[model samples]
Target: MKEQNNTTLMTTTENYEDYKDTTFDYEHYEELCVKHDIRRFAEVFLPVFYSVAFILGVAGNSLVVAIYAYYKKMRTKTDVYLLNLAVADLLLLFTLPFWAVDASIGWKLGNAMCKITAALYTINFSSGMQFLACISLDRFFAVTKASSQQNFKKRCWAICIFVWTTSLMLSITDLYFSEVKEHNGKHACLPIYPKDSVKEVTALIQILEIVFCFVIPFLIMLFCYTAMAKVLLKTPNIKRSRSLKVLLTVVGVFLITQFPYNVTKLWRALDIIYGLITRCETSRTIDLMMQVTGSMALFHCCLNPLLYAYMGTTFKTYITKTVKRFSSWRKQRTESVEEYTMYSESHVEETSSFSI
Candidate 1:
């Protein structure tokens, strides 16, 4: 009986040791699975990228807005669309600095800021893409169906309103779900859906974003530009080649900048729905792809002003006139200052001679 009791105690001790080992192993596995690489890479890459993007995007988009506002250059439906596009780009660019700081030092901003920033990012991004489509459609109408220009012009405001409403509606998910949540020992501003429906919600949102922000706009631009190209080919205008080149550049740049990003987003959506990636390494690779492609996508805002506004003949003329006027005004001010100084000196000298 004594030996049997001793054996039972030994058995219990072994069982406890086994359980502890198992728990430790499980926890160590989870720790290994944590994506330290992603955090390190983002901490290094995102801040610099976001800063550069913010500077260039703000400068370019602001110039577009300033030029349009100062010159009152909303002469055409295209102009109206481009102005709205500039505004959207500016709004989108404004969020970059926040993200830059967040990437550098986690999301120190509270949940409210997280929601606002995320919602603004989504809203302005979708609106900007839609505006690009609107610009393409307007240009197509201008070139192909010149008779419909008046009707399109009348509907421009309505179209702009629709785009804004649609973007806002799409961003409702971000506004609702975005939170400052702790992740891997740091807080991040991201959408955190209900645990019960997290996968469904994330997949749905990503797919919708891809569809509205990229697919629809890309299709519109493609169709309109292709049709325009056909028309240009048949026409005998001297600017046909230049127009074709511009169209190609626009389409090419859009594809190069946006396609890979959307592809990564689509992959992420699929992974959420289907668990396509199982390995930690593979998941980390996807995250890195997302980071790089997203940065590339954000570069489009910097190019929008140059491609859509500054490249236009009328806009170039406005820029030239504005620069010349500024130069002339500066020269006149300098001459006035010189003349005033000389007059003051001459008057002082004359007074001194009279006194003598």
Candidate 2:
């Protein structure tokens, strides 16, 4: 029995060696995942889920950008920030096709495209969060301060420039780090730093993003919204309950969507720094989990537009009108199709009877 077990172990080891030159053999890897399982539900979830998100996000955010650019024309700070937010979401959504393709098959795009796509993904994600915090700050000011319109415009422009510049600087590092890495005859667009600096740089960036992009921005939004809520609630004439509910809804959505993703990111960073999960299988598990959670974070871009629809009456009016027009057009098309079908059937009957 002991001799048979030893032989089986040797055969298994040899098979693993042979499998490396082949494709991503997930099934065989699962069998070998006794010590630690790298394969998760997300391997199946990502490709399909991200494709859906890409479609919805692109359609929704495009309409928002169009509204801002053509219909509204950026009359206020909110408009500018919302327009930038839509642009950022669009930027993030455009990268989803590359990722969806990569998740379904593998990274067929070469190194340069991989780097560019990854950079855009990270840049837009960072900027989107920054823009959220900016909008919150602008709302706080509008609620509390007596500001000249000119001053508000100047502040908004400065905020936009700062957010774009900072996020760009942060994402520039991805160009150096991201690469087309071949694994098991399948390519992955992975972050690849210098061999010596890889761990340090990766961990450092993750920590920085967690603090700046996630934690700090969240804290800012929390404080601003809380103060705004307080002032509005104290007012006798204000419809206190409705205003408070809207404020709570905004903060609640942010917490629910962003919190888990941020926590997962922080954990991955700590794992990198401390070697908490030392096994290769466990390391791959962390990588896959990050990808899934990061997609969740990106999904907030689409939902952000919905929150604006709920909050801004002007925006909601436009959205309702657009929705009505689309509904009417769809109804007309359905009626036309039914009419065409009936007419064709009658003509066919007349021709068949006469020919006989």
Give each model's whole-structure lDDT.
Answer: 0.76, 0.69
Clashing pairs in 2: none
Query: Per-candidate RMSD vs. true structure?
Result: 12.7, 9.3
Off by over 4 Å in 1: 1-30, 151-153, 328-356
TM-scores, all candidates, are: 0.84, 0.79
Best candidate according to TM-score: 1
- Candidate 2, residue 227: Cα displacement in angstroms equals 0.7
Question: Which residue pairs show collisions in model 1?
Answer: none
Q: Please provide, for model 2 over 1-356, each residue's C-alpha lDDT reduced to its tens digit, 9 standing for 90 to 100.
A: 10011111121111233223334553456465542122233335666777888889988889898777656767678888888999998998888777766654668889899788878877888888888898888889888986567767778888899999888888777777677765434566766566566557867887887776789889999999999988897788557888788788888988877787778677766754564553546645555555556666767887988886436788777778878888999888777665665678576664454311
lDDT of 2: 0.69
**Best candidate (score: lDDT):** 1
lDDT of 1 by residue, 58-144 (tens): 988887888887885476788888889999989988887778777767678798998888888888888999999999998898789
